[model samples]
Target: MDVSAETLIKLYVTMQRIRLFEERVADLVSKGEITTPCHLYTGQEAVATGICASLRNDDYVFSTHRSHGHYIAKGGDLRKLMAEIYCKSTGCSKGRGGSMHITSAEKGLPGSSAIVAGTIPIAVGAALRLSAVGGDGVSVAFFGDGAVCEGAFYEALNFASLKKLPVIFVCENNLFSTHMPVEDSLANPIIYKIAEAFKLPSCRIDGNDVLKVYKTGQAAIERARKRKGPSFIECMTYRWRGHVGPNYDVDKGIRTQKELDRWMAKDPIKALEKMLIAKRFLTNGEASKIVTGIEREIDGAVAFAKKSPYPPSDEMEIIRYLFR
Candidate 1:
């Protein structure tokens, strides 16, 4: 399917916003302004942007710890996202969910969880509900390669396939789970094979290319809307920063300088910016203006979160029930 220039540029902006948003949050954490553990999604923007691009406003999305891109891609408000990271009352979770648990039910983002593979079953459950109600909407579960080893992911996949539910399982195989590399963790690195065993339609693609990501995701989403069995997409991407922080070199033992430089050359934000210029949809001046504008918006979000008060401790009891 041909994506219009306007639509492509919007996706680029969303990806850039996600990258900058996470960067700013990391900076804030470094400066002690935000005291939360943040899993940055610096280089994996295309996977979320591409998948979310294919989804409707009513479709559901479940995310994992590395969810800033997923949340932003699915139309979560940046101001609220920043507020949640800052633990302010204006946050999407009312200052309790922190960086890992951002949620926007109105936008079909039920939430991201800290537990690995936890959202897989949730996405399956949502898909079952949508199928039962005969809704056109689909559900997407965004998880990492490590999550596949979990029993919940397998069970959810089996259920989704058996019921022919409208769900998409996006496995972002960044090749690492926390500090461990994929080679050390899984004997069979080919995740698509696992999907094949389940007889689910699946494909693996270069996650660095936003257009490729979009095309594959679009096809899968179209199939899901037609009530086809679940689709699994394994995106081969890289993370520019460490697993949980801004320091790119903090975990040098697992990631070498060569690998980092190689992935840096394929940065999603830069790739999209170059595409926009080559297509003449965005001039150099326009691109600069867009970056400046996004920075300003992020700055405003930080200020809003900083100025907003945290929920009263007495209200904590009321908030606890919402999680249940």
Candidate 2:
């Protein structure tokens, strides 16, 4: 498969967008301006950006509590995203869902759940619809390694594989499940191997490497769209922030500053920028401008969110939004 200069640059831009956006979100959370509990996606930008790079607009993506990257990478509106985080009426989910629960049906991000592995079955159901309705679209489930412990994860995999449903199970294994390390919780530390039991194609790769993720994801997406069967990918990545907030977990004694620095050294945005500059696909100056543009875009989104109205407070208006 051939990779173009444009595609490579686009990958870099998307990673930068996620990284910058998440950083700003962390800052906002620190200031207490955004009241929602945010699970920032900092070091793991490449996993979401690369996987989503080759996806079609109609293909669905279900995400986890750390969902900003996936939602943005899937072409969600930044303004709506920021608004939701700000809990404004104009936000996606109508400001009710906040950071963990965001959705844009038109953009293929049907929804995300704060509960670990909550959306896995929902993604399978979407794939079931496509399989039954004869659509080419495939559904993708993005969850952390924590989900692997949940029975719903296994059930979703089995049902999808059995029915040959068009779905991709993307396990964004960021080394730790909340504060617990993967090795501490899982008997078999190798996550992708579990897919073999269900007879699905699977692999584990360096999730920090955008090109590898992009190529592998494209292959799986292609296979699923062809109606062959489901595929699984276990992405080994790191989270730079705390499990629930902007702080690195070092202060909590769960991890160390040195360990965090080592991961930061392998920062995905910096890695991609190095490659792009080496290939003459981009320059430091060009990259700075790209980051500036993204910063401006994010600034606009923040401004929009701050100015937007909060969800209506009237009892009847609140009742209108409630479901049966």
Candidate 3:
């Protein structure tokens, strides 16, 4: 697709920023700096970066537990995200919502839910509202393969189809949902086919290829914006970390090292870097500089999070609804 050099470079930078941020979060988690049960979005950066690139600042995006990449790619403030994970008062959710529940309406990320398919219906509602107001804005819901098994997933799809809501359902099918492989969990492992049952336009693409993802996402977003109704995109990607920690799950015998190595070899960040280099959009020195800049940005965000104060004990009263 005849994409401009500037766009390609931006995609590369965004993916790199996510990779660096997630890596730093992993380090902080290991050092007890972030006590939240974190889910790293290391290997799945391309999917979020490419898809969010197609969305407007006003477009709504609902995310899942693995959402740092989604939030960052959707223009969320890096410092506030770090603070949220650190449980500081200056967080986007005011320190009440940790890693799994970060939300920024200003950035168009309404919220992310830890529940498997929790945000599906929320995105549908957002899209329905947008349609009622006669706007072209689209809402996107990002979920994993595990969420497809949830009844909520089917219900959301059925409603979206019936209403012709302006929404995009993106499933980051990374082969395994937690410890179970997709093959073992589903009678028919092809996820995009489920969308076909809803009579929605759908396709699966290589999530490791940022450009491919961008092209597909652009088409889907344009379709929604034009009031063509919901489309489903199944991005074939992988998570480099375990389900809820910073370590590789291969050590637990859930996934083989060979499988992890294969996906790592197809690293989305590296793929984009190589493509940019090949297209003369960037050189080795320039790529290195970009990486350095991202590292500095991450360092600054960490410093901000560390210096931010935690919420006062009395503030617990503000969250009294949780007790009931």
Instruction: Using TM-score, give the best candidate's number.
Output: 2
- Cα lDDT tens digits, model 2, 93-144, are 8889999999998899989998889999999999999999887899999999
lDDT tens digits, residues 161-233, model 1?
Answer: 9889999999999989998888888878899789878889988999989999999998898899999779999
Give a tens-digit lDDT track for model 3, residues 1-324: 799999999999999989999989999889888899899999999999999998988999999999899999998999999999999989888798999999998989989999999999999999999999987999999999999989999999999999999999999999888899999888878999989999999999998899999999999999999999999999999999999879998989999999999999999989888888998999999999999998998889889999999887775667773677
Model 2 alpha-carbon drift over 4 Å, by segment? none
Ranking by TM-score: 2, 3, 1
Kindly report which residue stretches of model 3 are placed more than 4 angstroms away from their true locations once superposed: 315-324
Better of 1 and 3 by lDDT: 3
Clashes of 3: 0
Model 3: per-residue Cα lDDT at residue 107: 88
TM-score for each predicted model, relative to the true structure: 0.96, 0.98, 0.97
Query: Could you tell which candidate, 1 or 2, scores higher by lDDT?
Result: 2
Cα-based lDDT for every prediction: 0.90, 0.93, 0.93
Per-prediction backbone clash count: 0, 0, 0
